[model samples]
Target: MSATTDGSRVRNLWDEAKAATLDEPGKLLYRSNLLGSDKRITNYGGGNTSAKVTHRDPLTGEDVTVLWVKGSGGDVGTIKLDGFATLYMDKLNRLRDIYRGPAHEDEMVGYLPHCTFNLNPRAASIDTPLHAYLPYPHVDHMHPDAVIAIAATRNGREITRRVYGEEIGWLEWRRPGFELGLELARFAAENPEAKGVVLGSHGLFTWGRTAEECYATTLAIINRAIEWFEGELKDKPAFGGEVVAALPRERRREIAARLMPEIRARIGRDEAKIGHFDDSDAVLQFVGSAALRPLAALGTSCPDHFLRTKIRPLVLDFDPANGDVEALVAGLDGAVEAYRQDYAAYYQRSKHPDSPAMRDPNAVIYLVPGVGMISFAKDKGTARVSAEFYVNAINVMRGASGVDDYLGLPEQEAFDIEYWLLEEAKLQRLPKPKPLAGRVALVTGGAGGIGQAIAARLMAEGACVVLADIDANALDATKADFAKGFGADQVRGTRMNVTSEAEVAASFAEAVVEYGGLDILVSNAGIASAAPVEDTTLEVWDRNISILATGYFLVSREAFRLFRRQKLGGSMIFISSKNGLAASAGASAYCTAKAAEIHLARCLALEGAEAGIRVNTVNPDAVLRGSKIWSGEWREQRAASSKIGTEELEAHYRNRSLLKRSVFPEDIAEAVYFFASDLSAKSTGNIVNVDAGNAISFTR
Candidate 1:
């Protein structure tokens, strides 16, 4: 509802009317959503909530206590009723009998399915037992930055006593499983007056006799920590004071745009990565501070933080005073390689005989002095969330380091959590990646039917798209539609007139900033005109050439420059027309401009061959459905020239085609998809006609 927290208070969003209409499980869902709605309260998917509810057993015909906990891989903020795993509380208690000790804790995860209640297929998470063992009707586990700050300091237990006194207790760090559950149960039994416990270097756990009480208590405890930190650290210099002043906002963005593609090109070798850049006040304050290098090296203290950000970040060697970007670029290879070696050594030092194989030995977060932070991942959402997690770590460091020594998780413990066999099993269970996963594409004229179709098709295969168009209103609507079907992170839109060189260049720069860099460029912007050569005015000829011919050149040239910068190869699909290779009466201006587009693709293809930048064209004829070009006088002119009414154009074109099929925007989109994907990996300087078998427009 409000920004996570405004320094002292976390908003309580529980409405009496809303809670009154829900049952016990519904109350738990509501409480979980209210807690998770704020980032300062918990990071995405970093917390779990549960309620011990009375349910009538289908097989037993008797009321039993069911542990309804947030399921594996579910985010509490957006979770539905089905996202919670239902388990018999009695069966979960029985697991303690076979739980041997810490060495056998992992085996307990495999036995959770035996405790399923009502056959709920949602798998239980590791935190399930922690909630099940708690002697409360409602329980919440959350990773609020303010509370973790106190929990991550060297003297965390002492600080916990100072902050909450007898209201809460503290427990030393233990990996979540059956063993930790037992420890929690023991703590609750010893301190009956305590409302919650801060797990060392981890998070906070609170309980109540009812769902609303639990939700209010969780907020109250976190808000107290926030207020305490504000009062204690009011005079302290954050991150041991700033060593380097932040660069200007525009300068920081310019540097990020320059470095992101270079970093992406190197780290994306094994699997392509999408990147996110953050120059927020918090990120800049930390990255430009005196303690940045040491703090970054020590890594994040929370397991949730390190899992997304990796054990540590690669701090780039850049000085804002000198502004020597070229030197930094030259040294990137060595810096990245060194980080990889260090990570591989960490795995080697801590791995057990049964540990999963080492994953990509690359840093997920990158720290740039005076610039900001950059994160790369298999998708835009993960990259952005990874950055958010690191920012949370920074907040913890600021509060912890200001008042006490900030301590990171032990290396061996962090490694074991990262390489746990159970974690590996979860990774293996994920769905396979789509064809265009991790790729970025820019589609000109994206508001139009053909452009929208092409953009949708590429997104279906997992490519992030930036839509550029001249119509502002249309562009916004189209982007909103696509974002709904795909996701907000997968699509963006910008207004541009493709014929203007400056606008074209700026649009490409925006794309680079939005999504690391470009991988596919669809030059589809167009205009149509019809007139006899003798009657064609200079104004008519120039207008057609400006948008259709020169516009293609401007966009193509920008794509080439970016492709060369990234060094990751690229695909450029020019949406030309059937008239490019075939002549039509009384349409000299349109035909000539279309022809120039095809030749430009050929020239660029020849120059880009050695660099793996493929160029191709998709030509379509009589695509009258939902096309902006057909909504104008061009339709009437073409219909007049063909000696047919405008309403009969679709039928005429379909009957004239060899296949007798009408060409739609979707048909053209399929052809463009081929060129944009690796399915056309070895082919370049090619043309495909989507005119339902146009004999006269055949390339051969």
Candidate 2:
């Protein structure tokens, strides 16, 4: 087996030289990482690997077999040594003595901690019994798309026999639990020559006497399925063939930009949502296919895929050939309402007496013909991951439908797994959401110190930020730094010249597509020029006014348009200077533009009141520290006018202030954060002076 595999085979990434230096548990971690490195083998957090190692008891001083498996809610690819749960095999096997059949199997999960070895704190997953009872020293269980594709077909058992002969067996679908583990042990004991078994409508399980052999066996089994599907689906029309040709790429994006906010507004009524758009070839093919509606209605087959994507997706009534987007928009209210009703009905029919309450009824995945797919969730990462899971479902549908009749899990069974008590407990244990959890903001002049600080403050409270700046290099660096601190999904960068009407419009459009829609706008892009009235040229005057006054106007206008479209209300914060209120010498153009920004914000506040769009301003004076505006001729001119050396400018400004303190960019950012958050909900058309007690610059 080669180290890397294309679509035709599974890559053999195990390094004997590397494995030789590690102990048994270390080798298990190595095997798990290697298997998870390929999505073709398993989706994120969808699989588990195990090794049974001999450890001397801390108290008894005698060697005993301990089963080490991936812990609850852990991802195999990124798991660490501490990510595994260790249990004594004898105690795990003893669990069968108290097992009271499938109805009481859930209670078994409560007893797993008692079986812990060496006082490991990591919680064992529900699949612990499956790995514990297996007769092999090493075991692998994965939800590979190709294997699940075979397992999801009506004729899956016969197909399994034909493809793998007697080397691999097949078992009908049973939710993972203690009873399933006994069944697996029974099968292994009965068929001593079998290498693995395909769990119908679920995934694959393989084992070996050694870690290396187990890793190789898992790859070979998945590769065989992949090879079989390649031959079987060779000439078959996928998803009953595409019925609609994909719209042009740019046209598709335009449609998504228009539709996402409308959909987001409706679905996000209970909790705000972030959106992800996927126009990948796989998504386009599935959404544009003749079988799209019926197959989607049947829902996903694998539990892993179904959980993230919801039971099924909502198929939009769109036709690419006609290009009737307005008609589609007109029908959105009805379409969205219908999906909600259908989902409620599903929950009503499937709910057990003790089942957890139904979750958000709106579908997670949205299918649009001629375009692609859109997924929404509480945050960007979940939305993106949900879309990726649907693509996996799409691939499963293609392979199963092409070779045999594709079969989705029974509705009741899916509901049991979805609302399982254990799953509910895990959800309850998640940390509370941050203050601005689902909010999205756009910050202009985002590469500047004030802008960066403001963005960081918003993101710290869980807001997704789009850093828009004309300086491409600065924007990239700031975006990277923010992404490293927050996650990559929480921040995006776009090149935007705030003064250009087109650029402002494009930037807002990008925000809508990137993260559903905007909730806040920070107009901070600016320039400072210092010259006596006689020396101030037209070029210098225009430069100051264009970026300070007109730039603020352009971005605010675009934000208002988006805010109205979303109908979710909004917040806008303008970064004005203290000169807007207090006169400053030799800076006629700069002072005039700064004053204009404050007035413009006041005007917008009045106009946007009915729509719940609050506009406010933050004024700062002599904020010399880390400010790009204070780095150039403006500093020298101000120093000269104050009759102080350039190097003494900070002291000069501090001594002039009533409180004798210097203002910094962080002070301005805090004022902006207050206005951007709900803390200032009832205080619109307000001005906050962050000038460290500059009495002349006070808002009063």
Q: In terms of TM-score, which candidate is strongest?
A: 1
Q: What is the C-alpha RMSD of each candidate to the true structure, in Å?
A: 1.1, 1.7
Q: What C-alpha lDDT do the candidate models reach, one value each? A: 0.93, 0.92
Compared to the true structure, candidate 2 yields what TM-score? 0.98
- lDDT tens readout by residue for model 1, 1-700: 4345454589788899999999999999988888888888999989999999999999979999999999999988888999999999999989888888888888899999999999999999998989999999999999999999999999999999999999999999999988888899999999999999999999999999998899999999999999899999987889989899999998988888889988988898689899999999999999989999998888899899989999999999999999999998988999999999999999999999988888999989999999999999999999999999999999999999988999998999899889988889999999999999999999999999899999999999999999999999999999999989999999999998998999998888788878898899999999899988999999999988999999999999999998998889999999999999999999999999999999999999999999999999999999999999999999999999999999999999999999999999999999999999999999999999999988889998
Model 1, C-alpha of 521: deviation from truth (Å): 0.9
Cα lDDT tens digits for candidate 2, 126-215? 989889898999999999899999999999999999999999999999999999999999999999999999999999999999999999
Q: Which stretches of candidate 1 lie over 4 Å from their true place?
A: 1-7
Q: TM-score for every candidate vs. truth?
A: 0.99, 0.98
Total clashing pairs for each candidate: 0, 0
